[model samples]
Target: MAGVFGLAEGEVKTGLRRAARLVLDTLYPPHCLACDAAVLEPGTLCGACWVGAAFQTGLSCDKCAAPLPGDPAEAPVLCDDCLRVARPWSHGRAALLYGGTGRQLVLALKYGDRHDIACPAGRWLARQAAPLCRADTLVLPVPLHRARLFHRRYNQSALLALALARELDRPALPDLLLRTRRTGIQDGLSRAARFENQQGAIAPRPRRARRIEGRHVLLVDDVMTSGATLAAAAEACFAAGADDVDVIVLARVLREE
Candidate 1:
């Protein structure tokens, strides 16, 4: 019968697609981003890599997400660095401490063309940032200068922001924040120097300023070191009449040494 033949054809097509997928997977099995060892799933690390990653949990600083030393009962403590410096954002969270596997993952994503890492990393960030997400929250990434954007071809922060936005069901506006000027690398810079370098580096786009007005804006970045860059970005959002600004990073540089 005609109906029977159509069902058989549909089954054959499904079988062909499954066979193709199996062949492709065999040729290029998913591998760990950090160690290059084959993993059971994509966007995941191997067992050894997971063991090395220092994920931030438990009691932490309310402002910067720094790991607190004392008993869990004494929470909401501000770290020494936060106490001395006034951060622009109200709250911040980081998925991993910037060392060991976390450092390796960040390097791979930023330089090694490993964009797949964003999915897993963003999912983790989404969980960490959930407390800040709201119906009117606008999610965005730290913008890159035009020159650097051209050279890199893609902004890794934007990739993570996009993924995080999807997970949180928030509106992602990549162009909301603009890097008005380029600054030198912040590597090995003192805290004060980093703050000075980022001065006037970022601003909200004039045409898109209204989008940020009166809304909770969440800024995403690959890593946070001195908190200077994030502070600068949050300042811009606040200047544009944003109700509040929060930050979420894939990793946080807990120590320089």
Candidate 2:
């Protein structure tokens, strides 16, 4: 239905959208994602922020996405932490190492109510998570306890999971896992204490059990510290009759070297 100046309706709509964006950008101006520095694009980091981000590129651990110094051609690598610990999930990937600009972005999205960060972080996650996905895989987030959800108003991990699912064109069940117990914050806890705290804390809902049965699952979360939280979530998936599970997170926290 061409109406104006021999242009198609779709073209007209696109032109209008571009015009609106141009006006808005001119007024507001784009800023760096991690910092407030001006950037040419909306969802980009500045030159300094880019250098400080520590995005994972090559030679990463297969079980968890920690950086390793080795040949890029190597296959099926494991980091020291993953090797020492028993991981219930089959595989894992992360978009960034949790420090510098990456850590700031995570904290912003998690506690500062900066939901806009999810859009860019999700794209970064999707790139790392793609190779781990399967046709039958069901993507879902590590659930937050009801109390925590009420206080925070939104679950940042669920937002990232939904964004990743959209990018991959896969099915996502956001409420598949339930945090039955309200465990306190895991920050500053030792490795063993963290695992003990998360133990048996999450489980699948009985009514929703059918949705998880026999499905291959991909668990998503914002960050992986001790990995105790993910392990607990994966264990819940298995309890719900999942065939197997893998994990992906926006960032992976590394122990001091």
Candidate 3:
């Protein structure tokens, strides 16, 4: 009798939740992730917003995913910037170039408290990151310092990572990495300074260190500027005994743009 009652009760609760969600959606239809214009789906851009985004579909650098000027059929090669710097990760990709609609979406997700943006952004990232995945891959986000995380009430990168994990049907260990120290804001910092500031900021959590060994670590982030933060995070994965490392970002700052 107890088992039968428990099963019926569970069904009732599930039905109630579904009904509540349906009512809520009807009362407040989903809006565009970028502009708040009504969209057919919850995590989509409206037509105007879609048209303005600069998706990186052309041939790009395998090291950084920065767009190159060769044929689309051409294989990806290293960008001049990637060649000039030591990127700790083996490969990287970004869904959008950081400008226009792309910048708006990134800023919204990062600072505007618009977490719904993570849905579409994560879908885009999952698509871009498919090529980087390996059979032994584990997904992790570049972490936040505890103080900053407390103030923000959330880590935007972690949100994106969770969403990507769902889309890709992969496990996301959001707490795998810890920001060892607070590297203050990167605004106006020279490229070298940004790299220096992020030099030792990230590492695998002590308890989670064992899971990283012999794994291909794929680091997720909201944006890549000088590739400094990603570089630091990749280094941490290596130190944690990761077999290989790759990176993906929602947007990347293309030099020409």
Winning candidate number (TM-score): 2
Better of 1 and 3 by lDDT: 1
The lDDT for every candidate, in the order shown, is: 0.89, 0.90, 0.88
Ranking by TM-score: 2, 1, 3
Q: What are the TM-scores, per candidate, against the unseen true structure?
A: 0.90, 0.94, 0.89
Clashes of 3: 0
Residue pairs in clash, model 2 = none
The local distance difference test score of model 1 is 0.89
Decide which is better by TM-score, 2 or 3. Answer: 2
lDDT of 2 by residue, 65-140 (tens): 7889988589688988878888999999999999999899999999999888888888999898898888888999
Clashes of 2: 0
Pairs in steric clash, model 1: none
Q: Model 1, 39: alpha-carbon shift in Å?
A: 1.4
lDDT of 3 by residue, 152-227 (tens): 8888999999998888877899999999999999878888899899998988899989999999988999988888
